[model samples]
Target: MVMKTKLLLIAIILFSTSSFISNRPVTVFMIGDSTMANRSIQNKNNKERGWGMMLAGCLTDRVIVDNHAASGRSTKSFINEKRWERVLDRIQPGDYVFIQFGHNDEKEDPKLHTEPGTTFDDNLRKFVAETRSKGGIPVLFNSMVRRKFYCNENGLYTDSLIDTHGDYLLSPKRIAEEKGVVFIDMNKITHDLVKQMGPEKSKELFMWVGKRKDDTHLNIKGARIVASLAIEEVGKKIPALGKEIRRYDYVVATDGSGEFFTLEEALEMIPLKGKCTVLVRSGQYGPKPPFVNKKIKITEEKGVSWGSSAAHAEKPLKNLDLYLCVGQSNMAGRGKLSPEVMDTLRNVYLLNAEDKFEPAVNPLNRYSTIGKGLGWQQLGPAYGFAKEMATKKHPIGLIVNARGGSSIRSWVKNARQSGGYYNEAVRRTKEAMKYGTLKAIIWHQGEADCHHSEAYREKITQLMTDLRNDLGIPDLPVVVGQIAQWNWTRKPHIPEGTKPFNDMIKEIPAFLPHSACVSSEGLTPLKDETDPHFDAASQIILGRRYAKEVKKLIKK
Candidate 1:
């Protein structure tokens, strides 16, 4: 409800060295049923956030996420309410029209019901024609998959997924193809993800009340994940719009390893007399210059304030996908730095105790309990995972709070933490959320809990529950990294009863709702000796494994 709409102005525009300092903002206007609607958090729907609400987290200031979708509205009802007219009135060149529907349209009632090929197809054509009339691109997305899996007698899933919104899915695809608009298959992607998550875990990605499950609507985690899936598809189907989304930037760092050594080099390349705009950014690029230079003038930017740089604004990009990595030794990373990992830097970043979001380097679990959150162990799974998440064009932020020798008990709310690890984790999580939305938590700690294996499940579950409540994100998912294998390692290093402990870690999902486990099977530990920590390649692969599992918890 608060985001701005895009406007196409003449080319002559210039702002500070910001990404996409164009004539107008790129607007993405969404229209559909309650599944894609803008929800009010002030009432019963407080916990129910639609995918549109979280869409902003995936984009930079160059684009706008303007959601006009409403609940319980079918194609006929939307037209009658003048919702489509209001969206049409605001249409501009270079703007996008994202259309999705069907939940309310299947009703037997006349006002809500529309036969797929007849009324539904015709209505969809109206939207495409009108959008094209305004020189706007139109993209159609099918309905999302409901979290309905086939279950056994004990309430566990026996199969993958079940088809709930049947013919509705077919209608949108046929219409998009026939009308020559971009088509995004959200249902297929979400259906596969739901099946992979199974029955019990899939419910966490939807709205589940006291025995009343609204699989059609999503909670905050569900919304964010679904939004990511939609945008990813949008990027694929609409490549030009995808390029504007993010993943590339003109960064002029203080060290001068960037595209330009000085702003003068940047300005000299651009033609300032025309309507085209050039952005100039710097970390410590000396004295400021006049706004207008030979017909060039500066314009106020969205992400860039009057005089903010990368160090000051913390590399503002409107919003970022933030994850908190907290656990023990393996999470603290003990791998040797690999040369390949050094070259794997992109949109991934780490938030340190100093509150700066810098380009993420390995040994990410530095909480002062180990080392600085920079240049350690050569690489961690956080490196690969952060890179994976950022590849979608969203700025990814990681908050590190791992301790080397901490047990599951150390993560408890009132547990004994000599270094205040748990307390510091809570403090940092609360602080980091002020800068970015708390997406999920990546955890890896079980080697120390091996000795006290009896209390492992309860302590770990309590840790997750407490963290979510304290952070005010009741459904925040936890990605548990199953401890590395130590049975094959040299004699003295392998701890007693290691197999059972790892098996117990694998069963964590049965006791928890939104949590998922990533196996460390076949992962090679440190060679020449037998420590539980993973080696450079293993840690890198393990981070991607954790990332792959978390992708299921969040999206497909």
Candidate 2:
């Protein structure tokens, strides 16, 4: 009681702005060999193990990494043991499953060895199919390289970090490309990481204590570093799971003065069904710790925000209606905040530009002067769109990833490598799905690309198809918003930019199943020629239109 009182006193003096997250933690199902598995302590010399042991520590508390990897189990043996069934049985929607197995498969044991592109590919397909069947995303990885440096008794190191696993790496790469699933080249990533450590220093990473040089298994330090690299890959290629890494803290407050304080407070007033973040300014409040249970997570930043109330807490994401908001400035949200819009918002949530889930309020996009004057007033269509669905069976959430002035060409997956705008958007979408079902992808582009009206339809269709393929959503519904017609376009400023683009949008539903486009025909522009985005009032109707179209698809 004394210790508890001390903690409560700290909570009051150093005010805590608690945010109760509504979703379940994101679970990472890890299936791999000894390189990525946990091992039992055999004896005093049992310091050797897999990197999976250190994965959870590398990740935030929200990510639950369930490592089912074993010492000698390959993909073939893992299935033979019926372990794959156990993993699939509990697999649910919005879960991430990782597979890595090659070391034992490379050995002479016929029971475990799998031919790179044949049996290996076959086994991988089963994992992918099963995971997708349960609506869970499957990720593949190659086993880490052994720390076998080609050296003699002269201690002359040469050709370090050799790829002994042979076609094992090739097999996973082929499967990933063939199936369009996310694949992490653990062998390549860790090999490069280990090579940087050098041969002598690299020994510290392997199971080489004093004299025992078992280069296969990694020690605590090696495992931790290797695990860190593997996780880093998780965020790199499979961005959806990457955003949930929780590498740092997000401060929330009672007063709307922090990065996410406003969104958090808005949800607090309502019976928020999922998690949102916030930070409050200093004020006179009771000196008592929140009656926290297993669901709550309390954390403190460097105490930089106003007052000692710079507390942050969030769990892994789950169980919400996740949407993807992508496109140009209008989609970036130029709509200003209104009282009606704010008041009507309920369990609406958004995955912010920062990849954090907060209450979906106005300006669900971004503003240049963030944490500055009038910045908090930024509003957008996501709030109203999500709110319209709040009364439905599920809670509402949006992954907002839009820019002010980007062309359609920039959204192509190949083009995303250099600028990374499209990749970031995909990453945010994946993060949002960590907690919720991805119900729809909302796009409001074309003003910038409207000039290329001839290629507009094909570009739109191709991008949508590739996006679905990569995301493993074969028939995910797409809701596109048509660009507003400006007087300049009518007066021939750029005739191709307006009517042609709008015409293409009208035909989207005809070509794609479960797809629809919302019109801005009756909607008026912001009226500021210098800024031709939708006005605050018009955004409400636009959002509702989007909701109606998505709802129709849901009903169907």
- Each candidate structure's TM-score, on Cα atoms with residue i matched to residue i, is 0.43, 0.44
Which residue runs of candidate 2 sit more than 4 Å off their true CA positions?
1-317, 353-356, 367-377, 416-418, 490-497, 528-531
Scored by CA lDDT, what does every candidate get?
A: 0.67, 0.65
Tens-digit per-residue lDDT, 361-398, candidate 1: 44466433333222222356787777677854577778
Give every collision pair in model 1: 11-275, 12-275, 17-280, 17-281, 337-378, 381-543
What's the C-alpha lDDT at position 410 in model 2? 79
Tens digit per residue, CA lDDT, model 2, 1-556: 5566455434422211111032445557788888787654424236665787666545544555566777788889999988787577545455678888888777778778788878888999999889988767778888788887777679788756566878888888788767766678888887887788888788888878777878888876677567767787777655544655543222333222122233233233423444433232222122233433433343432212221111211322357777887777677665644334444245566565445555544456642211111222245677668777775457677777676557788787787433576677677677767777888888888877766777878878888988887777989999998888664354456644477778878889998667998988777665344345787677878888999998998888
Pick the lDDT winner.
1
Give RMSD to native, each candidate.
24.7, 21.0
